[model samples]
Target: MLGDRLGEITGSVTYQRVLRDDDGMKLETSFQATGTFLGVSVSDVGTYVTVLRPDGTQYSEGRGIMTTEDGRTATWTGHGLGRSDHAGAASHRGSLCYQTMPDEWARLADVLVLFEYGVGADGATTSEYWEWK
Candidate 1:
């Protein structure tokens, strides 16, 4: 079961590039966002690589770091599958695992998170996370 929503972030795609084309069309993208996570203010930055499969689906893996307003940090990695509309919009669902600095927020290390990620044609991005129960 999915639990309460843990966080949400709105950001912009900072960069994107074609990485390869031989087997499948692979691309790398990076983004930046600011939002509240685990009830604390944070800034996030991440990069992900995606491959366009023959059936028009996409597979991606990404890793990122989030820093709290006071300097504490956490790291996360995730994988997801999605499809584009061929008109510059896409949506994905994935799982995320996090590791945090051993502090008050360390409980995050024991939690499994599920996420919904979306990108608009103009490069806007939104991500929402929920705890897995």
Candidate 2:
């Protein structure tokens, strides 16, 4: 597992479609992800799919595994949300966090990683994350 403060994920959008084009837009997207943890390469992170609505609400689900550069593996399923940020240009900001077990990681089952995303109501985007001990 990549803990909150140790690993970071990079995602490539694999699919995207407009579900609703009305004023409060709705979009569906899929992503192919990769990551890094404290100088270690974590590969084949997983596939992530999400639906985002103008109401500052987003729901996501994903299944993937992490393999350290040295070949240790950890798998997990994740789900999370984004809520309207009350003070930051109305951008919805929140986290998609989860836990997993890496074959060689001590306390493998206790890692919780969080990935955060945000889109400003003013037409901008932001991201961040942190995890538990």
Candidate 3:
């Protein structure tokens, strides 16, 4: 994703992924943001759910998928909640691509993330990244 600060309200993001199964994939990700929207300093938690198509394209459901602390840092993590095309599968897994803004953009908020996922009987893979704006 890519965004710019409009006086106070600023946004930015960039993402990409690959398929790891034949049953399709599901990715749930969250982020912490501390920034002023419309010049009003604000802080809040945001979350999202991405349903991956067999061809690799995906869609996101906007909801609170992560949490933030009293300060300015937020941590995000998500797991497989079944697939869009199948409900009887034992499990599903995939990867996540994330980016963060600069501190000057978040004057009041910051973003942190812990991403993890699993494929079939394999265990989970976890990674971390940070962003502020």
- Give the residue spans of candidate 1 off by over 4 A: none
lDDT for each residue of candidate 3 in 1-133, tens digit (9 for 90 to 100): 3233322212222233443455567555443344443243544344555677666445554333221233433232333333432331122332222233335434323332222222222222222222222
Model 2 RMSD vs true structure: 6.0
Q: Which sections of candidate 2 miss by over 4 Å? A: 1-4, 17-28, 83-100, 118-129
Best model per lDDT? 1
Query: What is candidate 2's lDDT per residue for 1-133, written digit by digit as tens?
Result: 4344655555555555665544445555444445665457766545545556556676666676767777777666666675556663322333433355554454435545565654444434333446655
What ordering of candidates by lDDT runs from best to worst? 1, 2, 3
Colliding pairs, model 3: 1-13, 1-14, 2-13, 34-109, 47-64, 47-65, 105-133, 106-133
Of the pair 2 and 3, which is ahead by TM-score?
2
Quote the positional error of residue 41 for candidate 3 in Å.
1.0
Q: What TM-score would candidate 1 get against the native?
A: 0.93
Each candidate: RMSD to true structure?
Answer: 1.4, 6.0, 12.7
Clashes of each: 0, 1, 8
Model 3: residues with Cα > 4 Å off, grouped in runs: 1-23, 65-133
Go through the candidates in order and give each one's C-alpha lDDT: 0.88, 0.54, 0.35
- Tens-place lDDT per residue, model 1, 1-133, is 9898989988999999998767767989999988888788889999999988988899999999988898888889999999889789999999888965538766667878899999999999999999988
lDDT of 1 at 118: 95
